[model samples]
Structures are given as C-alpha cells and as structure tokens.
Target: MSTTALSKPWTITRLGWLFQPISDRGHEEAMVLSVYRDHGVIPKDSRTDNFNRTPENLSNYQLVQPGDLVVNRMKAWQGSLGISEHQGIVSPDYEVLRPTAPEYDRRFLHSLLRSRALIDQYALRSTGIRPSQWRLYWDEMKTIEISLPAAKQQRAIADYLDRETARIDTLIEEQQRLIEMLRERRQAVIDESFSTLGDPSVQLRRYIKFLTSGSRGWGDYYADQGERFLRIGNLPRANLEIRGDIQFVDLPADVTEGSRTMLQEGDLLFSITAYLGSVAVIKGDWVGAYVSQHVALCRLERDRVDPRFIGWFMLTTTGQDQLNEGAAGGTKMQLALDDIRGLRVPTASIEQQRRIAAHLDRQTAKIDALVAETERFIEYARERRVALITAAVTGQIDLREMA
Candidate 1:
C-alpha cells in the first residue's frame, strides 16, 4: 500500500446506501452497551471508568443486535463508534444503524467508520457553537461520502488489520504495565528514606508562621485569562510540586490583600476535602495562585523547615495516616484548619532534609524519564495503528499482496 494513494478502483458512495438507522425498543432486559473512543463498543459493565451510570428506568433504551453500528453522536468526531458484537441496549441518545447492503463486511464497517479520516469528516459536518458542543446526528452522518472496495477485499483488509493492531496493542499494554511498576517503586523509595531520615520531630504548629484556609464563593472571579486559581485537583498526588491543568481567575485588587489565599513561594498547600492526603509545595510560577476553599494554604516558616521536605513527607504512608486522622466533618471526607495545624511532621536538620530530598530528586527523575519516554512510544504506536487501519479500510493497500 502506498501512503499517498489507493491501490485499486474503489466505489465512492454515500453512507446512506450502506446503513439504515434503526431504533427497536423493548430490549431493556438485555445487557447494557457503551461506546468508548479507545475501546469501541463493549458491555457497559465491562468498563469501570464509564462516567454515565445506568438509569433505573431502562424502558427507553434502544435495542442493539449483533453487527449493528452504534455511534455516540456527541463524540463521533473522536471516533467513538463501533459495530456491536452483543445483543444489548444502549442509551436512547445514541444512534444504532443496521447494514442494508450485503457488499460491505461488518468488520470493515467498524474499522472504516472509526478511522481518523472519517472522524475528521464527522467533525467537519457537525453543528455546534463550540468544538466541545459539536454533535453529529444520523441526519448529517448519512450524507457523508465514503469509499469502499468489494465485499471480498473488505474482509481481507479487516483480517490484516485485526492481526496487526493486536500485536501493537499488546506491546503498548506491556509498556503501560512497566510504567505502573516504576511508580510503585518510586513511592517505596520515598517511604523508606523518610524512615531513618529524621530522629527528632516536632508538631507542625511549631514551625508554622501563619496558617489560613481558602475562601468560598469566589466563582465570580473566575476568568479565561488571569492569575492562576489553585483547586484540589491541582495538588500533586505523589510528588511535591503542583501539576495538571491550572484554572485562572481575575481577582479584584480591592479584596486581594484581605483574602490571604494568594500563595507565595515555599508555601505548602493541602487538600482538606474530597481527596484528602494530597499535598503540594508552591514554586515560582505558582507563587500568586489563589487557593480554593477546599485547600488550605500553610505559610510555614520556610527558613526553619524545607517546604519540599514537608511536602514529600506528607505523601508517605506514615504522613498520609496522620493527615487522614482528623478528616472528619460529615459523610464526605473533610479536614478543618485545626486538623492541619496540630499535625506532626518529620523535622530533621536542614542539611539532612535537603540530602533526603536530593536523593529522592535523583531517584524519581530517572524513573519519571523512563515513564515519559515509554508513554510517548505508546502514543506513537497508537498513531501507527490508526494509520494502518485507515490504509486498509480505505483500499489504499492491495489485499492480494497482503494475502
């Protein structure tokens, strides 16, 4: 197959001739199915990460038979459609299409419709105010033009992709497992080091110059472009520094000084609600970020104790237990300002603390670099898999040569 051109004569036809929209009801007793961008169509119960839960009332769900095409119109542009292998029911919001022509292979339809080329088409034809809101209904999808080979060639192409993609997927899974192992090792190193790193310890209150909790009802100050607004999600889970997407807020100058939530360098931030035990040490770029009420801003006596050391200590098994000891208020996990002030931390000599932190810095960096490189490899492997599928289904590859 040539990357730039097809190998054989292909019929360019509208998808309207290939599929007919179907919405058979009264299959509420059947298994529930969902479409995922990466995994395609599978039983909803099989995935633990699905955000949409099954509603108690299944009377409105649409029936899906084997070989039926299911498309999540909201995410069609992201390739969230697949040919179902099970007789199940899906959300009424989803579109189910049954093949009307015998010339097309079921597996080919699954691969072709989910290809990167077709995803771009879905995105182009969708209607919405913004990209996030774009929706591609069947009315628009049916009108899209597609190229297909004869039924025999379609089956051959599908067979080739099935084998190739499986190999690539297996390799990616191996790398993913390795990344998980490295993370476990990283945590182990931190815990073991903290054990003998310090002998003399003191209450965290002793080193605290000032402690304050973030304010509530600052939603009005949120903006697309302004100073960073730190939320609980931004607090690092295993590491000492803040990470992930940052939210910006245009704070009013009049109330900035009184808020006391504007963080400074060397400040320690703790997640006081929801996901407790998460902590972060503020650095240069995060200096002016305003913390949300869900997080507590602890302006410690930085000169007395290294904020990074304290931050790293909080992530250890011993530190996590202490942090969660006072996580109480209601059904939801929570922590009050008092809970943080009275907490105990491993306070070693400044030189000893820096040594421990430096040792961890070197160890974790090596592991982190390997993880990042492996992750990039998997990403590129996925892109190649998609390109192969796109090539096969679009008749760019000579099926006879593959055989």
Candidate 2:
C-alpha cells in the first residue's frame, strides 16, 4: 500500500483569482457558449442555429478565453462550472475566473469543485429556499475553502481521473447499447407473434364497448395527493408498461365532466397526441386513475377480445405502422377518435388470444429482468466514477505514486 500525501486547505482566491469583468462592449462577433451542468461549455449555435430572433445587442455578454474558469452563478450549486477551452462570449450573469498563480492546476480545481462535497458547500453558500432560485455570488464563492494537494500530485490526480472516468463511461455506453439491443429483440418477438394473425379482421369499434378521450380542463384540478392522473409521460413508447412519473388530482364534486375517463382494471390506454403509439393496460393499482385529454380509453368487450392480447399487438411494429398511417397533423402528431375506432384489428378465438398473451408476458418479463440488471450495473458504475474523482482530487487516494 502507498502512503497518501499531506493536503492543505486553500481559499478559492489563493488558488485562482476572479477574472476582471470584460464586457463585449465593442460588439465583436464571437461564438456564444452555454455553461451546462455536468457538460462543460458548449457553443449555443451548435445546439440550435436559429439565433435570428436573438437580440441584436451583444454588448452585455462577458468575454471568455481558453483555460479560463466559468461559472453560471444562478446554477453554481448544481455544478454548472467548468474550465472553458474556447474563446467565446457567455451570458452576462456568468462569472469568469483566471488562474493568477502557475502553481495551481486548473483541471484539478475543476474536478475538485465539481465533486459532491464542494457542490454541497456551494449549496450551503447559496441563498435561496428553492434550488431554482439558488445563487452563488462572487463574494462568498471567492472565500470558499478547498483542500489542495501538491502541484505535481494535482496533475497526476487529474490525469488518473480523466483516464478512469473515460473507461467507466465507455462501459456505461456498452451497457446502454446492450439494453437497446435487448429492447429491439423484444420488439422482434412481438412482431413475430403477430405475424401469424390469420383470423378474421374487424374494425376496432366492433369489439370495443367504449372508445373516447378524457375531457379537457383537468389541469385546474391538479393536487399534491389524490387519484393518480396519468399523462402522456406516464405511458411508455411501444410498450404496455406504465412509467412511475404519475401526478395526482382531486376530483371535486364540481369536476364531474371527466368522470367517464376514470380508468378501470384491465382498461387499455392509448396516447392520442405527440407520442402516438404508446399503450398501457391499466392494472388494479391504477383503477381510479384518470388520463389527460391527450390519451384515449379503449374498453374492449371481454367476450370478443383479450385486453393483454390487444396491448401486446399494439406494441408491435406492424401496429405502430398502422398507427402512423392513421396519425394526422405535421409537427404535433395526433390520432383522431374516429381514426382509432376505424383501425383494423385481426381477431382470434379468446382461448388463442389468452395463450398468445401468456407467452408474450413470459418473454417480456425475462427481457425486463435483464434490462433492470443492466441499469443497476450502470448506476453502480456512475457511482464508482464519482467516488474515484472525489477520492483522487481530495487526496484520499495518492495518484502521484501510481503515476
């Protein structure tokens, strides 16, 4: 085992002094950089080229250069600070700092400040009840203290973190790709199962007892606690699973207009707008839940069609293709209630439908288990990455000997 080096507490001002504010009063044409959390400075134009509507005046923006540290004061607590590698102009609200002493490594400072401990320190220094309103001013920021390692160790630590984090990130990317492939395989399975639909075709309305969308004006009934209010976000794309980002709304006596849209067990919910093909079968837990106007409720006749079978079929590519064909509007896609009612569905005997649904349910459960495992592994990798950076930059682990 190697012994760790001694560390000393250094004030922010001692490490690197704040930059002298330089306004773009000359109106020089320069790229605009947006400082983002986790991600460093990025050109605003690269994200969106439509800056034609931007204000013609650029005199209030601050000029930044390579190796300069930039911080979004309002979001500093959220780790929106980075060392810029571009010569550009940032919003006037951002603070720019330059290293006055050569002894301090900018990369080391960047890593250390972004660590969880320093982020917590920033939160403490910030003055606001809400995170969105929190701001870290220059006066308090300059006086903040951070542990400093030897100059040589600073570079070694930063280098070690840069290399290690990249390796972990690559692992995460591979895992994400595996998940995508698994999802594609799941889709393939559903498609194969539906390919043999040789039964008689009938319009969806012939089998569905009810087909209608929820009424509008439910936004005024939003509450912190009540019946679950399902929205487009709660419905996963091309799947029968419901997401956990559920909202609650109080169904007041006066708001009886949307009562018809209240979900029942085994009810099929379909997104009518934006995300057109998202479908989910409402379970017992969501029995009282009501969907937004953007979603449509389809109550199938139990004697004619199995809800799970229909749900599985809708998740297939063929089903999504039919939905796309029926979808209307250009930018904001939507499916009319009449179009949904007119959709052609291949019908089979109830017994065969049950068997198909059972097989698909088993297969999807296995795939979902694998996906959950991969996601958990990715989470662990991310946690390890953060821990490694924290340990290296804070001198908890000595990288000088390793280097």
> What value of lDDT does candidate 1 attain over all alpha carbons?
0.85
Tens-digit per-residue lDDT, 1-403, candidate 1: 4554445567899988888999898777899999999878899999888788799999999999888889998899889999888889999989999888855788888899899899999999889999789899988999999987777778778888889999999999999999999888988988998988554267889988888888887788889999898888898777876888978888777775425888888888899986889998888898877888899888887667888888888888888888887886568789888888878887688888888878887888898888899899999999999988988787667667653
Supply the global lDDT for candidate 2: 0.80
Model 2, position 167: C-alpha lDDT score: 99
Show the lowest summed lDDT stretch of 10 residues, model 1: 1-10
TM-score of 2: 0.86
lDDT of 1 at 203: 82
**TM-scores of the candidates in the order shown:** 0.91, 0.86
* Candidate 2, 1-403: lDDT as tens digits: 3436434442434322534333443444888787877577777676554353445787787788877778888998988988887888888788877655546677787788788888888889898889899998777777677667667767777787889899999999999999999999988888888788864278788888998898888889899999899998888875687886778998877777768998988888888887778889998678888889999899999888998898888778767877888885566678988888887777788999999999998998899899999999999998898887787777677454555
Candidate 1 residue spans exceeding 4 A from truth = 1-8, 197-202, 222-228, 244-253, 256-259
Error of 2 at 72 (Å): 1.9
